[model samples]
Target: MPEAYLWDRPDGGVPIAVAASGPSSSALAGEYADGVIAVEPDAKVLELFDEAGGGGKPRFGQVAICWGPDEADCRKRVLDQWRWSPLGWKVNAELPGPDSFAAATQFVREEDLVRTVPCGPDVDKHVEAFNKYVDAGFTHVAFVQVGGESQPDFLDWAERELLPRLRT
Candidate 1:
């Protein structure tokens, strides 16, 4: 059976990992995966993974960020672009299509979006929010910029303001 053995990689440079949510998945990753893409900033989950994994394999996480020059615009953009994310990744992944997602999130409010996504012009808030994942042991983070546009303003702010402080 395929499960009876592992296949050799062509070059061995590929870093294989699994998306782990809790203890059982983390244990499975410990046994077979090179790292884990954790869905939340939960320290206990990472602790369980570390304890079971023999050490800390690379841990990865994502942070949803919605930004504009002002707080109200950011909130509106977050509500429009990221409202569906409140249902979490499992739901997001399983959602049948865009219309399904739209129907599901049509009634979602700015308040709801702001609760989970970091939406604002404040650089410190963004830093503080992402630090939770870093504190939770994520070795790498995906900063998801959610807005209807390219948001050059957000990117510029990130490059000029966020990156410098994050490096330190």
Candidate 2:
């Protein structure tokens, strides 16, 4: 939708480093691997892929990596973070508004392009923006929950609205 940034890890909620060994690992891996659709950041993604035991061939759909604030920071702060290449698109963009989502959709679709949309702690504020992005032809919406306080709200809204819109 908007140029929202997202970070994709093999895992889900837990940071990448610990996610592999975290408790949620198995559960995270199991949920998406069957259909192999989209992957949000955190440790869960990896868990699902590995557990599926597909021998490197995931059972789900396609795997898309999200590069949001943390992803950007990793590319900047971490050493040699560019190693995450070889994935699909490298999404990075500021919130695109000022123009209606209608215009935004036309541009991406006409150009045959996809980009990330940046989101923060504000659920109501972000959701309104998110709806616009979906209207604009955004197929996926990844919420980078950088803080503990914001995680639940952002995710709840995503599941309720954003994710449903993307599926259709």
Candidate 3:
């Protein structure tokens, strides 16, 4: 095999984060990577990572959220767009494509999505969802607003309501 090298290398190296959904991978991330990222607020992942020497390292998490004027519509939108989220990474990874995901998540209920994701215009619910990650030792938390053309509204609401509460 021929050797390959980078033509340009920066003075400051970039941080590497490993996305892990299971025990082994989480431990591996702790052992090798600069940080770990998980889709859910799973304390066990962090525990395992910390045990493997990832203590004090950045832990990033992501959650799905939907905010709108109507609570029912927001719930429906999250259910329609992100119902597949509760399937867990193993099942989500095995799916071949969007059609397969749709087929797999067809039976997912709105309440199921609500249990995991904060849906609607309630600032408290959104804050609670973000807090779950924070309480799980995650240093940084990000959210995915599941909808269309509502980014501006969401940002505004988050800035006015969510950010202040989380800061406190």
The numbered model that scores best in lDDT is 3
**Could you give the candidate ranking by lDDT, starting with the highest?**
3, 1, 2
lDDT of 1 by residue, 1-168 (tens): 666988687786788888777778777877778887766787776777777772668888878888677788888877777788778766776789999999889889888877778777788888987899998888988788887474687789899998998999
lDDT of 3: 0.88
Query: How well is each residue in 71-112 modelled by candidate 2, as lDDT tens digits?
Result: 344233212222222222222123244343334333242112
Query: For model 1, what is the error of residue 76's alpha carbon versus the real structure, in angstroms, after optimal superposition?
Result: 1.6
Query: In model 3, how large is the Cα lDDT of residue 62?
Result: 92
Candidate 2 stretches with Cα past 4 Å from truth are 1-56, 59-117, 120-143
55: Cα error in model 3, Å: 1.5
TM-score, structure 3 vs. true: 0.90
- The TM-scores of all predictions, comma-separated, are 0.80, 0.24, 0.90
Ordering by TM-score: 3, 1, 2
Model 2 is weakest, by summed lDDT over 10 consecutive residues, at 77-86
lDDT of each: 0.80, 0.36, 0.88
Q: Mark the regions of model 3 whose C-alpha exceeds 4 Å error after superposition.
A: 1-9
Query: Candidate 2 lDDT (Cα, whole model)?
Result: 0.36
Q: List the residue pairs that clash in candidate 1.
A: none
